[model samples]
Target: MMIYTIRASRPDEWRAQRTLRLEALKDPAGSVAFVNTYETEEAFADEVWQQRAETQSFIAEDEVGERVANVAVLVESGEEFEEPQTHLVGVYVRPEFRGGGLAAELLGAAIEWSWELPEKVGRVRLWVHEDNHRAQAFYTRLGFVRTGRTMPFPLDESRTEYEMVLERP
Candidate 1:
């Protein structure tokens, strides 16, 4: 059986975080799933990676100590929302580790962290590509509902993305 642990990432885990992100950016859905490209992220400075590690990011590590999955929550503020919103992003699981509940675990960590924030967060939100039905179903199964908001995909403006949200109770 495979053994793994899910937990928050530390500042010193920048290297591991970068490695995992690079792997995610190479996946088939990477173009639609991530706002940034692997080539762009590869050029980021070490400090950028460190800052990412310091964010509310969680990682799933295998028994051999390799990071196999990651997710993060960012508290966002804008005139469009009445209260601060917790935005979940950077969700990815290595292909070999997919379908093992790792994505759910990562999302649970982000949701739990959002609820524990110092300030009140109105809800948790995430964007999934419109063509990615698998991800849409996954988020729906976790209690998120489509908000009917659509935005142009950054990588390909011709395509669209949908916003899904889970309100805080």
Candidate 2:
């Protein structure tokens, strides 16, 4: 079995972050799973990634020290929510590393980290592409329930991305 070291990504790891994100953008499901395209992200400067790396972006590196998966949570707050909220985003698992517990384990870590956040997060929410049933099922199994709320996908307003939330316990 392959062992993985999952931890928060550092600004210095921007190159690795960019690499993995580009790979994810190349997936067949990328259109629905992610709003960005490889070309767009590829053109971003290193400082952009450095800034993004400051978030609760977690990465999983395999035994050989190769990044195989990634996940992140963004703390959002305003009139839109009662309290500070952790929004799950940027999730990806390399094709070769799918169909296993790695994603779950890494997500659990991010969830645990959310609860530890100084902001006192009330819940963890995520957006899933309307047609991405596989991702929907995975989130459901992790205790997230549909919120019946949706917004127009950024890239294509005609399409939607639904919401799911898991209250912190």
Candidate 3:
């Protein structure tokens, strides 16, 4: 079995974050999985990447120390949310490191972090592209259920993105 070390990414690791995102964007499903075009992200200033690096993002590193997966939990706060909530963002596993439970581990790390946050979030949610059945299946297997809520895909309004949520028990 392959062993991975899951940990929070430091702010100074924005370069690593940028590299991983670019790699994910290069994947075949990249066009559907991510809203950001490679060109747009590539053109972002270092400050943008630095801001992202400050988020509560988890990274899974292989035995050789190569970061293989990532999952970021964005804590949501607003009048709409009765309690603090977390939204899963940028969830991805490199094409090569998939199928070894690395994705699950990355998610677990992110969720656990959310659960222990100062805000004490009770719910975690994510958005899955309507056409991305593989991702929907994966989220379902991890106990996430569709909320039946949909939003126009950011990149294509005609397409949809469905909201899925997992309540803390």
Please state the error at residue 127 of candidate 2 in Å: 0.3
Candidate 2 lDDT over 50-125, as tens digits, reads 8987776888999989999999889998898899989989899987888888989889988999999888998999
The lowest-lDDT stretch of 10 consecutive residues in candidate 1 is 113-122
lDDT of 2: 0.90
Q: Candidate 3's error at 94, in angstroms?
A: 0.8
Clashing residue pairs for model 2: none
Error of 1 at 123 (Å): 0.7
Off by over 4 Å in 3: none
lDDT of 3 by residue, 15-72 (tens): 9999999888888888778988888898999999999999988999889988888888
> What is the lDDT, from 0 to 100, of the residue 17 in candidate 3?
94
- Cα RMSD, each candidate: 1.3, 1.1, 1.1
Candidate 1: regions farther than 4 A off? 78-80
lDDT-better candidate, 1 vs 2 = 2
lDDT tens readout by residue for model 1, 64-164: 88998899878897787788889989999988888888888889988988988877887999999988888999999999998999999998999999999
TM-score of each predicted structure versus truth: 0.94, 0.95, 0.96
